[model samples]
Target chain A: MADDIKILAFDVFGTVVDWHRSIMDEVRSMHLDVDADQFALAWRAGYMPAMQKVMSGELGWTLIDDLHRMILDDLLVRFGVTQLSEEQKRHLNKAWHRLGAWPDTVAGLRRLKQRYTICTLSNGNIGLLTNMAKQAGLPWDCVLSAEVFQKYKPDPATYLGVAKIFDVEPGQVMLVAAHQDDLAHARACGLKTAYIERPLEYGASQVKDVSPHPDNTFHARDLEQLAGLLRC
Target chain B: MADDIKILAFDVFGTVVDWHRSIMDEVRSMHLDVDADQFALAWRAGYMPAMQKVMSGELGWTLIDDLHRMILDDLLVRFGVTQLSEEQKRHLNKAWHRLGAWPDTVAGLRRLKQRYTICTLSNGNIGLLTNMAKQAGLPWDCVLSAEVFQKYKPDPATYLGVAKIFDVEPGQVMLVAAHQDDLAHARACGLKTAYIERPLEYGASQVKDVSPHPDNTFHARDLEQLAGLLRC
Candidate 1:
């Protein structure tokens, strides 16, 4: 099974990087008036719908950075946090770029790198992913984002783009993501899928049900276990 | 000067990797019935003209890998080297993916990476660049290619695209290359330029003139000296 896979395309936000905790930490450090958890969750909650607008042609092609900023601007008003200047808002919005990886991410990715080509398949723009990787020491062979394909994940184009980029069959590429929906989409696209158990992805208050599905090719608690399962 | 630059976008072929020597070595190892040096030079010489065809819209957007194979097929016919199977021809074309880095490349890149984002700004497609980096251990922060823009080098789009990817101003991103013409084009796009002297880029017989250019921000004998000059 390990020998059959040539590339492992990871979903970055919740699987590779602990975006919930990372964003929560940033919000806490900022001492914003709103609850840190709520702020973080609210910010992330806007992501999918925002991407949907672009996907539906309701919005012109905008980068994840711009979408993030737009969401942040609305959240600031909704949360009654009005003290930030433009520069402060910009810095706070770039918090996504400083996301720390999960505890096992760096080591697991390094282990996987020894065998399969490991890369980020995320909605994050190239700059955001590159900055996050540099900061968190995620050793990606390459960084592929919606910025590359101009279509966010769950889009067949983004899932299939990985295989096209490497000149391999879709089955030869495995999409490792915490979200079952993402993995299901990849599987539907004829790519193999690995479910990463990120129960705390939405924070401890909202633990996700990481129960294994029969459709997934593999399931692991984290990237370390994924590497082991893949025999990397 | 270094403080002003946020990214160092490198030209991979001659600046980071010694394609001439690497190709020559591969040709020699293959024991092809042709002059290895001439064969290596011929392969590289096909590169620019091929890219120009795509740039001119005479040919549709083509990945460097396909362009390389096209050129390789022509060379195999031109050099009267007909005794090769399809698999052997494919392997020969992938020699580009296995090119060795220059001695100073790894160390210099590590040092420079500490200060600024280091990425590839090359005409090579992502797969070729990613495979080459993985094989050669070129620790690039990101891989930016002509494939990303669907335009080859010397096109203002490729140079400007690097700045756009990093969300930096063109002047904040420096183009580092062994070829002055590439640097000049980058400069014309308002990008800072660093020229690395790779006199043997065309092989030992035809030494390249790597003289200092006044317009360049920095000029060094190699990446090692470039690192030292930048105080990295």
Candidate 2:
């Protein structure tokens, strides 16, 4: 399974970056009276449903940034906080752009890039991925997103699109992600699968499901371990 | 014109990499009895026509790599070269992936990337551009290609697509290239245009049209000079 892999497509957000911590920190700094942890969770809670609306054809194709903004507006109303001006709301929406990467992201990716083409395969928009890379010094050969394929994660088009872009068979591409559903979709689409353990992805207080699967081609404690396992 | 420009989109073939010289080098190293310069010219001469076929909907969308291979096959027949095996032919087609950059590419891009978002806006496919970047060390924040927009250069969609991807106005995005035709198309689409001089782009012996145009937002001798002019 590992022999032919030429492209290692990554799931962004919780896989590569500390989104919950990043969002919680930003919310805490906002001095909002609501529980920052719950606020972060609330903000994230709308992500799947928003993407589902697009996936189900109930909504037109929209960028994750725009979906995120819509979610932000709903969250603010639910949390009973509406003091932010337009500029402030815009800036707050851009917090996704400033997400910090995991401890092993840069060095491990630098290692993995030596052997495989490294890229982000995310639901995020191109601008968000590009800005996040710039902010976090994440070196991606390409910043591919659901926006590029016009479909969200779990969509076979999105998984197969990465392979088509590289002119390689889906078996020659590997999906490295923290989510089981993501890996399952990639695996179902004939790509190799690697599960990355990001224990603190949700937060210190909440548990994230990071169990291993027999079908996974590789498993690692972190990106550094994966790099080592891949002999990069 | 440069004041509001937040993204610098680049043309790759002649502007960033000397394709003529690089192809000539590879052709000469192959020890074919044909004139390497003429062969290189013949190979590139087919590029625009092939893309035009796609643009005119006479052909389905094709990647530059495949188009390059098609042109290479015809050029080989024209030049009376039939000794190459399938493996050799495949490797030769990938010569585009190994083209060397101009001396000032990496450093100047690094300097410019410190402020504005820098990316490739080329007709090349994603795999070709990604492999070329890996081989050339071109630090692009994102690799935006004609493949991404499914339109070749000089098309309004290709130029305007960059602005849409970044959620910016056309005026806030700039097209930096060596070709007058390319810059003109970009300017017509309302993107700021910067013309860089690649005097020996077509090979030292062959004269290329590198004349300046008044409509260019900026003109510089090279990427280093462009960086200096932009105060990066």
> For candidate 2, lDDT tens digit of each residue in A1-232?
5668899999998889999989988887888778888888888889999989998999999998899999999999999998999988898898999999999999999999999999999999999999999999999999999888888889999999999998889999999999888999899999999999988887888887778988999998889999999988
**Cα lDDT of model 1 by residue, A154-221, tens digit:** 89999999999999999999999999999999999999999999899999999899999999999999
Taking all chains together, each candidate's TM-score versus the true structure is 0.99, 0.97
For B100-203, candidate 1 gives per-residue lDDT tens digits of 99999999999999999999999999999999999999999999998888788888999999999888899999999998889999999999999999998888
DockQ of each: 0.84, 0.84
Clashes of each: 0, 0
Candidate 1 TM-score to native:
0.99
lDDT of each: 0.93, 0.92
Tell me model 1's lDDT, rounded to 2 decimals. Answer: 0.93
Candidate 1: pairs in clash: none
- Which residue pairs clash in candidate 2? none
Error of 1 at A149 (Å): 1.0
RMSD of 2: 1.3
